[model samples]
Structures are given as structure tokens and as C-alpha cells.
Target chain A: MKTIFFTGKGGVGKSTLSAAAAWQLAESGKRVLAISFDPAHNLGDIFGRTLGHKVTRFSANLDLRETDLDEAAAEYIRRNTSILTEVYSYTKAFNLDRYFKVLRHSPGVEEYAALTALEDLLRTSDDYDVVVIDTPPTGLTLRILALPRISITWVDRLRRIRRDILDKRHTVHSITGTFSEEGQKLAYEEKDDRVMQKLTELFDRYVAVARHLESDANRVAVVFNPDYLSLRESQRILDGLSDLNLGVNVAFNNKYTQGLSEIADSMERELFDGRDAPPPVHRIPWEPYRREKSYEISYDLTQLFAL
Target chain B: MSEHQPNFLIRLWRSLRAFLRGIDQAQRERVVALTAYEARELENMFVLMLLGSFAGMPSPPSFLAVELLPHLEHEIRVLNRRAESSTDALAEIMGTIDADA
Candidate 1:
């Protein structure tokens, strides 16, 4: 399945643009799942429905979800804590439960949770032809985008450390003819080491996430208004994605007006500099009167995102 | 002569063999302890890398570290003990020497 991410500064019409894109894709008879990862969720509001963490069917071909980032973070910690408890039942004496309770409030947990949620959606989205993500503001969205690659480096070092520890244990075991101490059986080989196995599993997961983010199946689009702050933030978003060796597939100049054409052209020049073939820039004209339904405005923008 | 007693040369030979075996066993135990200590030191380094953020050092992300917590029972136990006895200077010195050895 192809994955598309819509990100920009707050109140830059990301939810509207991504919602429109999803509606357009679904209208074209393609199965689509549009998810909102913003903590301040408005995708459901735009759709005129109350959506939650659960997937809701907005139409015959479209599914909608607004991820609860707080709940996602909590669930991520709880799931890993349960796994730790299950594997090391004897660690109760160390008060790991209390320690994990503190982990819920730890830094970067939200970003990690967001990454995992995206990973899950991507992994299980085979039934859908396209998945569009409405992400949080620039900072959090950039961190989430960069997480997979950053995490892969740490996981790689951890795997090496685990291997060294296993090698030392093997040496000790060979000399002592014993691998158990204080009723705990230590693994001296890579295959038998649970820590090594966990590290390898995490390494593979990080690698998969990194590959998915950098692959052709993924597309990123930046949504912004033709204003100074929005243009600057959009440039930052472009630079951030470039730092991660990823490119934007499109740019949505939302609320475009004739007066702001000069500013918009400058933004395009700055954001797409040094590129031989820059992605197309689609401008959504300003509406004189607000429409009762989002589809009314989205109808024209559909062809811009045609598959 | 007592019925339990052996001849003088046989008794001397048996005593000598027993003495050598005692020294050999002691050397074997020392080697075992040293290897075990080295292995433990390596394990400590591994745990430190994972949990270094708590020590004001850069470390792996907590989500990843927490997943390996199950297999870190021994390291955690050692950390708890170290924390409890951290103020003991003599013990710390002895530990340093033991680690160095």
C-alpha cells in the first residue's frame, strides 16, 4: 500500500488537505484509510463526525481514525512492561512495575508511540490501496519521521554490546562449566540469550521502519498558507526531511489568493532549490463563502492527488 | 601398629597427592571466579549503555531499553546492590581491584 503523510505548522490546513486527499482517493474507487496523528485532532470535525481511536467507516471506500497520542504512549509502555514482567517474573523484587509507571511520563515516549502506531498502520494496511496520515505540527511530526533512522543506529550499537556480553559469558562458561548463578540461568550463546534475541528483534523492527520511510511507497506532502510564518515552517519541514534523505512528493498551497502569488513563488523557489525536477505545487484557491461540507472544496483538489 | 594406618612411604605419597590436589582446586576456583567477574563486568557495560540516560549520559531510547528489561534481572539486582552500598569506600576500592584483576 502507498502511504502519504501531510504535515505543516499548526492551523495550516493539514487536516483539511489530507482529508480532501483521502476523500478524493476513496471517491476514485480506491480503498483508503486516513488517520490523524495530531494531538489536537480536527479530522473528525472536518468530516462532521465524532471519530475516536477506533477506526470508523466514513464511506463505503474510506476509513477514518484519530489516534489518541496520550493513550498510544500509555499503551506502548504498558505493552512493553507486560512483556518484561512475563519474561522476567522474578524481577518483581526489583520493583520494575513502579519503575515502568514513571516511564509513562518519560521524554520521547510520545514520539516513539507515534512511530509505532504508524508502523502498525503501515504493516496492517494491505487491504487499503492508500493510507494518508494527518500529522501533528512540524516539531513532533519531524521527530516521528526521523525516529526510525535514529533508532536504527542505537539499536545497532545495542546489538553489538549484547554480542560482546554474550561472548564474555561464553568465555566464562567454558572456564567454569556453569552458566547459572543465584538460581538464574545465564545464556552464554547468541541463540540462547533472550537479551540478544530482543535486541535483534528490535534491530529488525527499526530497520523495517527506516526502510519503509525511505522507500518509494511512501510520499510526503507539506501543507502551508502563503504567509511568512507558514512559509518559514514549511521550509524547515522541507529541510528536516532532506536531512533524513527523504523528499517531499508534493506541496499544497492552501488558501491561495492572487495577492499572495509573489510570496508563494518565493516559497517555492526557496523550498525546491537545487532540485532538477521539483514536485508539483498545487494551489487551492481561497473561498469567498465557507461551504457546509468539506467535500465541496475538496472536489477540485481531487485531481491533484489522483493515483 | 593401628589397623587403620598404612605403611610410612604410602602414607607420605597419599599426603603429597592430597596437598597437590588442594592447591589445584584452589587455582581452579580462582580462575572460575576471575572469569565470572569479567563476564559480569561485560554485562554491566551492556546495561550501562542501555540505561545511561539515567546517569546523565546518552543512551538508547527508553522504549527499546524497557523491552530488554526482562533479561536484565541480574544487572538490575547488581545495580540495586551497588546503589545500596555506594557510600562504602572500602568496599568500592575492593570492587575496583577485583574488577581490575
Candidate 2:
């Protein structure tokens, strides 16, 4: 299955383009799932449906979802705390709840939570032919995308230290004869140490997600308007995605203006002024009906996305 | 009365066995102390490396940090003790290296 991520500056209409693409892909009989990773979700507003944390069927071939990061983060914390209590029952002296409260306000919690949510979605992505993601605005989306690699490296270091702890525990068990045969088995078996096992699971999952993202099955579409600010943001998004090895498959120049043709052309030129020209750019002209209550992607716009 | 007063040879052998048992116990105690000390040092190093971010050193990712925090109360307490005794900080670092090696 292929994954398509749409990312750009705020108000650049990435959601609109994402919705149109997913809708069209489904029309062509592909099993598609459209997800909104944006905290301020407008994908549901664009589709005129009340979407929540659950996947809502838009059609037989298309599914829609809007992630609730707060809920997902809370659930993640809860699960982690329970696992900690169960696996390391000897650490009951620690006020884990207090530390969890501190973590709730710590930096990078949101991105980690979002990654947790994304991992959940991608785990079930094999059921579809394509997954369209309407990512959060520029900065946060970039951080979220870079998280998997960062997390894997962090875990690798941690696993090394954990191994040392287990070795010490095994020595203590042998010297003191403190534990039963089963207890010794759990402590001495590197694979049975709960912390090491969890870290390995987390590391492997991140590696899988990262590999899936960098594979040919994934496509990233950089959406931007024909203005200097949007164009500048697009460059950063393109560079960020390339850094992660997720090459930009296409570029969408939405809301094109014919009367200000020179301004648009000059901005586009300056956007890629010092770099190689990007992938095929599709320009969609301004439509009057886009401002209405329920916006519809015209057949012409749908056809453009098909390319 | 005659049964109670075993032979002199039997009494000598019993005393010798008692002496040997005492020496064995003393040696065992020293071995136990050394292993316990090594185990404590290893546990401390593991905690310091994993939870260093809480002590203002950049450690692992926050999610991992939070997950491991419950098991880290002892480490945090040790860190507080080390931080309180700033003069011993250098000695503590040296000690960890010596123990690890």
C-alpha cells in the first residue's frame, strides 16, 4: 500500500488538495483512507462530516479520520504507566504519577503523541491501497516526521544501559541466591527483561515506520499557494522531506491568479531560483464555489490530481 | 555420666570443625559485601545514564524517560545526594569509572 502525505504552511489548502486526491483515487476504485493529522482539523469541515478519532466510511472505497492527539497522548501515558507498574513492580517507591504530570507539560510530548497516533494508523494501513495524510502545519509536521529516527537512536543508547543493569541483576541473583528458578530465568534472560523488551519493540516499530516512509510506496505532495510566503515555506517543507529521504513526488500550485500572472510567475521563479526545478507542478485556477458551505472539487480539478 | 564425657579425640575434632566453619563464614561475608558493592555501583550507573535528563543532562526521548521514571526513584534519590555533596561530585564520577572498569 502507498502512503501520501500533504504538508505545507497554514492556509495553503493542503487539506483541500488532499481531500480531492483521496476522493478521486477512490473514484478510480482504489481503497483509500484519508487522515487529518492537523490538531486544528478542517478535513471534516471540507468533507462536511463530523469525523472524530474513529475511521468514518465516506464511501465503500474511501475512509476518513481526524486524530485526537490529546486523547491519544493521554491513552499513551496511561498504557505506559500501567506497563511500568506491572513490569517493574519493585519501583513502587517512585511517585510515578507526579513524573507523568511533569511529562504532560514537557516539550515534545505532542509530537511523541502524534507519532503514537500515526503508528497506530500505519499499522492497519495494509488494508488499503493508499493512505492520504493531511499533516499538521509546517513546523510540527516536520518535527513529527523526524521523530522516528530520533526515537530509534535514543532507544539504542537506552538499551545498552539496560543491558548493563540486567547483567548486574543476574550477578546479584547468583551471588545471593535471592530468586527462584523462574525469577532467575526472567532476570537472566536478556529477552525476558521487560524494559529491554519494550525498548526493542519501540525501536523496531519506529524503524519500520521510517523504512515505510522512505520507500517508493510513499509519496509526499508539497502544497503551496502562488505567493512569496507560501513559496518560502514550501522550500523548507521540500528540504525537510528530502532530509528524511521522502522525496517530493509532486507540487500543487493552488489558487492561481491569471490577472497577477507576472507576480505569480516571478514568485515561482524565485522559489526555485537557486535550486533545481521541482517535480511536475499542477496549477489549479481560483474557483468561486470554494468559499461556499460545502466545497466541491470540480471534475477538472479531479482530473489534474489524477496526474 | 560416662556417656556425656566422650573421648578427648572426639572433643578435639569437634573444636577443629567449629574453627573451620567460622573461617568459612568470615570469607563468605567478605565475598557477599564485594558483590553487593559492585551491584550497587552498576545499578547507579544505569540509572544515571538513563535518567540524566532529569538532572539537567540531555538523556533519552521524553516518552522513554517517562516510562523509565517509575523505576528511577532510587536513582533520583542518589542523584539528589550527589548533587547536595558537590565536593564529592568529582569522586563520584571517578568511582563510577573505576567500578565500570
Candidate 3:
């Protein structure tokens, strides 16, 4: 799928830009899914409807969803716990609630939750010609963008360890009678062992996501206000994406008004610092009166289509 | 004793069966011992990965660890024993007797 991610500092007009792009893509008869990972979602307000965690049809050929992180997190935990409970019923004595509490505070919970949601979309996105993601502000956006690569490595190591353990267990089990207690427990059938199976599934899922994001079909557009702070944040985002080998094309200078163009010219110059200027800068016109009608407001954002 | 004596063929067949059964029993015992040895090593390795956090090695994500915790109770017990013992850590896990310890 052709994926375009819109991100910037708070109030950089990313959601608006993403909505516009989704609308334009749909108008051109391409199936489009525009999703908001921003906690403070304005996509719903733009579409003038409350979007839940599920995909909501915005118009013909267009769909939108604002991911509810808490809902997503709970669902992620519930799904994992159920699978774990089934595979390792013996964990019942370990005060699982305490461990789950630890998971709640785990450093990368939000990132993993977001990644889980993204992987779900990618797996099912064959129906869409393009998927446009409206991400959270600078810091969280960068973290979420980097999540797949980090997670893949983490899971890969776990898989190797699990495989070795299983291999040993298999050798032991074949020698022991299958009816023996330890033999039964050590049964390491790759097809039957759900714990190992889960690891393998996660490993494959993470790898697929990492590869997809790194592929040329995926592009990131950093939305920034013409202000120095937004520009600086965009630079960090650019560097972060480059580190992941993700493509960043077209920085959108949004909410243009009152000689902001002049500010953008100097800011862009300072930001790029003689490196090949990051993607061409696209100037979006200021439309205060039509602010409520974000879809219409963003229709003029056709420059993104060229990207 | 002469009245109870079996045919020569039948007596020979019974003697061969008993001898083969003895050999099968010995082979089965050896296989079971070898398997038990390998199984212990695998079980220890699995425990190390899942509960590595307890040993100060970074574990898989806490959520994953939590999920695997139930299946790892036995491993955890073994780990606890190993931790409490003054025995060499490597020897304890590999199921080899430490002569010095």
C-alpha cells in the first residue's frame, strides 16, 4: 500500500493536511483510509462526527478512524493475556495482576499499542490504494515511527532464545516416553507449542511491519508551522526518519498568513544547512472562515498529491 | 518333572523371548536417561530467557514475560533453587555435577 504519514509539533495542521490528502485521494477514485493516532484528534471534528476506534466511512472511497489509545492498549493486553492464559495456565499462581500492572507502566506500552494497531491496518489495507496516518506531535510521533525497528530486534532475540530452548526440549522429549510428566511438559512440537508459536507470530509480524515502513511505498510528510520551533522539531523528525531509512518528502508549511512565507524561506535554509533540501516545501493557504470544514479547506492541498 | 516337561521347540522359544525383553528394557532405560539429560538443559535455557529480568538481564517486554510466566513456574522454581545454591551457575544449569562444589 502507498502510505503517507503526516506529523509535526502540536497545532502544525497535520490532521488537517491528512484529511485533505485523504479527501483528494478518494476524489481521484483511489480507495483511501485516513487514520488519526493523535490522542487529541481533530479528524472527527473535521468530518463533523465522533469517530470511534473502528473505521468510519467519511465518504465514497474514503474511511477514517481515530485510534483510542486506552482502548487499543486494553485490547492489546487482553488479547495477549488470553493467549498467554491458554498456553501457560500455570501462571495463575504468579499474581498476574501485578505483572500486568508492570506492563501498564512498561516503557514502550503506548508505542507497542500503536504499532499493534498499525500492523492491523497494514495486514488489512489491501482494500485501500493509499493509507494516510495523522500522527501525534513531534516526540511521540518519532518514537512511534521508530518502534517497529526496535521491536523487531527485541522480538528476534527472544525468538532465537526460545528456539534454542525448544530444540533442546525436543531432543529430550524424543528420547523420553511421550507419556512421562517431563516428556509431556517438554513437548516441543513447533506446530503445537503456542508459546513458541506466539513468539514466532510476533517475530513475523514485527519483521513485516519493519520492512513495510522501510519500503519506498511509504512516505512521511512533516507538517510544520513557519515558526522556528516547529521548523526545528521537523529537523529532528527528518533526522529520525532518515536513521530508519524512511522517506520524508514535502514539508508542508501550513496556516500561511501575514508574511509567514518570508519566515519559511529563512527557516528552511537554516534547517537544511546546505544538505539536499528535505522534500520540496508546499505552502497551504490560510482559510480561517472554512476552518470548521477541514475537508474543503484541505482540498486545495493538492500539492501533496504530487508527492 | 518328566510329566510336566514342554516340547523342545516351545522351551527354546520361551528362552529367546525372555532374553530379547531384557535387552529392550536396557535400551529403553538408556534412551530415557539421555532424554532426561537433554530435557533438563532445555528447561533451564527456557527459564533463563523468560526470567532473565530477575537475573538483571533485560527480559522480553514485561507483557510478554507476564504471559509466559505461567508456563515458566517450574523454571522459576528451578531458577530459585539455582540462585540459592552455592553451586556454580553454569554447572547447575547444564545438569553436570560440579566435583569441587
DockQ for every prediction shown: 0.49, 0.30, 0.31
* Sort order, DockQ high to low: 1, 3, 2
Kindly list the per-residue Cα lDDT of model 3 for residues B34-93, writing each as its tens digit.
555455555666677766776788766554566566556556665665556636655543
Q: How many backbone clashes are present in model 1?
A: 0
Q: Report chain A TM-scores, every model.
A: 0.91, 0.86, 0.88
For model 2, what TM-score does chain A reach? 0.86
Per-model i-RMS: 2.0, 3.4, 3.6
lDDT of 2 by residue, A1-307 (tens): 8888888888888888888888888887889899998888888998889999888998899999999787777777777777666656665667554554455667778889999888888898899988999998789898989999988888887777667766765765666665222232335457766667777888899998898878777888888888888988998887887787667777778888688678777766766666554666777677665554333566343443333
- Over the stretch A152-251, how does candidate 1's per-residue lDDT look in tens digits? 8988887887777677677767866877878888888999888788878877887888898898888888888988888789878888888999888888
Model 3, position B100: C-alpha lDDT score: 38
Q: Can you give the TM-score per candidate against the true fold?
A: 0.85, 0.79, 0.81
Q: Interface root mean square deviation for model 3, in Å? A: 3.6
Name the better of 1 and 2 by lDDT.
1
Error of model 2, residue A225, in angstroms: 0.8
What does candidate 3's lDDT look like per residue over A1-307, in tens digits?
Answer: 7889897888888888888888887888889999998899889998898998888998889998889877788777777667656655566777563454456656667777888888998899888889999997677777777777776676777667667656755665665535334333544776766667777777788788888888777878888887888878888888887787776777788887767768978887877665554577777778775746667764355446454
